[model samples]
Target: MGIKESDIKQDAACTPGLSNFFLKDHPDENKWADCVHCGMCLESCPTYELTSQEQHSPRGRVHLIKSVAEGKITVNEQFMDPVFACLDCRACTTACPAGVDVGGLIEEARGQIRQAIPLTGLKGMVSKFFLKGLFPHQNRLNSLGSILRFYQKSGMQKVVRKTKLIKIMPQHLVDMEAIMPEVNKPVRKKYKNQNVIKSKGKTRNEVSFLTGCVMDVMFSDINEATINVLTRNGNDVIIPNKQTCCGALHVHAGDRETGRKLAKQNIEAFNDSDKVIVNAAGCGYALKEYPELFREDPEWHEKAEKFAAKVEDISKYLYDTGYEKPKTELNTRITYHDACHLAHGQGVRQEPRDILLDIPGVEMVHMPNSDRCCGSAGIYNITNPEMASAVLDSKMENVPEDVDMISMGNPGCMLQMAMGVQKHGRNQKIVHTIQLLDWAYQKEDGKEGL
Candidate 1:
């Protein structure tokens, strides 16, 4: 918490507003310059695939960043739109022969833009409230969750739905409300003054759980399932009381100042554990990339690197650590939706699918374009609902017919897919990979399976 004023430079030498947002150490010119402008990334890019526009493509976006760095173009809405429009999904990185870090470049550009021209109006207010106002503070996040829990449990949801009051709201808002998971008490409350949840049997490892902001607030059951699965796999899970949100949203939104603040707090919170486990793919991606946030600060950068090395997504960890094959049969057909952050960001494609296939009686169907963005690129779905929904329509269209469930590693994907299911009246359940594993472990017989 010893954040010095000089630690973050207010001004730097570059094209007017350019160098101020991006640190001298980053958006590495060499990285963007490596792009040979081959069109291979076009097919993999969701935005490009949807729009077929050059500006929305990865190579095009890289060109924009390169232009800004060279003083050819100012970082205005023209520049900002292409940069922010990117899913930061790293799909381009996978497709790039030159190995351009498109996601990193986009994030770095966003940092510059946010610092230079801070958002104003309703967007600014909401961004400020969540990025700086709520997520960085654990108490405030939980309080907001508590308020949500009240609305869900106090018959307000029923009243609103029954009275048709929701008709006055935006269609998306009403749709989101309908698919929203019933809020539960935050996982922090379940521990009851305890910091560590000891494994039931011979403990193979000691780890810290980053019960992320939205992961805990809306999908608390997933957090609980993650703990159960971790323990069942022979790990002592430590729920660090001081841990706040992973600040993925902050970083994604280009609020690196706030992201750096949260990174420092989490690095200290989970310092003692052998591993820092995350259930959500987006949080895992952000947590694993924390070192990038301190590119200019070598000392903290080293510490962050060490801290990030231990951050593992639950599916990857379970597959790596090995697990008992489920004896109970789930008896349901399922397809796996690769969360962008998991498949492209973390290079985790097979682990979650492999686990699902291992479960007895679960039919694993290959979902076409399963790795495509579900239109829930953090707040992209909210900020750009039309584009987000179009992407989602593609995702829903490809969802294999008659699949009873769709399993994913990220909570955002779960919510987005849930909304997709509700929109199309598919009646399919969207669940976490860890939740399925937890259910398999807890089931004593065929009578139980979500």
Candidate 2:
């Protein structure tokens, strides 16, 4: 029902040292008040499902944040765990009858942590490096990509494998490295002076493409497929060379200033295009929510709103544009895993599936709990390995036995699923939905797809 005065008194009494560390920032009270202590979100939360801890659930975390907001509790280590432990998959929001924005609240709470508490030691170092140093700078990120490509193609990887050097490294690191996709030459390199790519026929929609940091470096091929698929559907694609990373990872990790900086840069970069197409789910979610970053500044707020209005996930855009169904048949049984950001954050559920089912000879099987998080909540896999792996185990068990492929929209999901396939030694192919769509489209002309 509702929180009682007596229960609030009890909660205040239970948590000691409240005066020592006051919360300089907290999630909005109105948002926290939306939660009616309904346990409907429990089943949908990955951490709650694994540990069965009340504090790990959305409602419990809301209560904690509410207490902190009311000055009854402090923003300490104990409080940070409940807030950071959330996968931010937005599954709870999907399940909540009250429509409490759990993901937004968690992110806001994370922002509070970054502002008041601030991470230190290795976590702080790494966060500062990537959030500030790398992601916001396209040239530095591409250089790192080049180094990774060297590691992959310079025979160094072969030596590591042949010498059993991988044995010394953590299994997770080794597994992640093993499944690393061949790094294609960065899109900026391939399309050096090619900014605007005209449609094959009449141009239907002109859009700017966001080639995200990790997406461009590791899975550059996906960006290539995205461009091809858009042009195939009569979209004149504009590659904005100046557009930086969408600052999703930075925001998720609670670095608001950096996130906001990158948001401004992106808003400026894609200013000319009314339609900004993003294939990666995380990037799409962040780009669409850029307005949220500038809520307090009316001038930037209006600009951010206008910028976000142009953002669209590729599958959702394709389906909305009435994509042509491929005549070429790809005879295989496949299951679609909904990336949390694409399915829950962006509210894009059916478009990818609609595109998949439209393909000739493609059989779609319903995977149990297909919308559940695959434990790749941005950097959650690396930060919270045990919990991440536990959640991933639940996800992997839901895949159908005879499924030949697991198609999803996000790059993070693709990497996580690839890791799962490697761990279990399954013969399933993990690929992006657009990749598969591009393949089938190419098949019409007697070409094979990766």
TM-score of each candidate structure, all chains considered together = 0.94, 0.93
Q: For residues 51-105, could you state the per-residue lDDT of candidate 2 as single tens digits?
A: 9999999999988877776566656678788899999999999999998988887
What is the per-residue lDDT of model 1 for residues 306-395, given as tens digits with 9 covering 90 to 100? 999999988888889898788888789999999999998999999999998888888998998888889999988887888889889988
Model 2 lDDT-worst window of ten: 17-26
For residue 54, give model 1's deviation from the true position in Å.
0.7
- Flag regions of model 2 displaced more than 4 Å: 1-25
**lDDT by candidate, in order shown:** 0.84, 0.85
Which residue pairs collide, candidate 2?
Answer: none
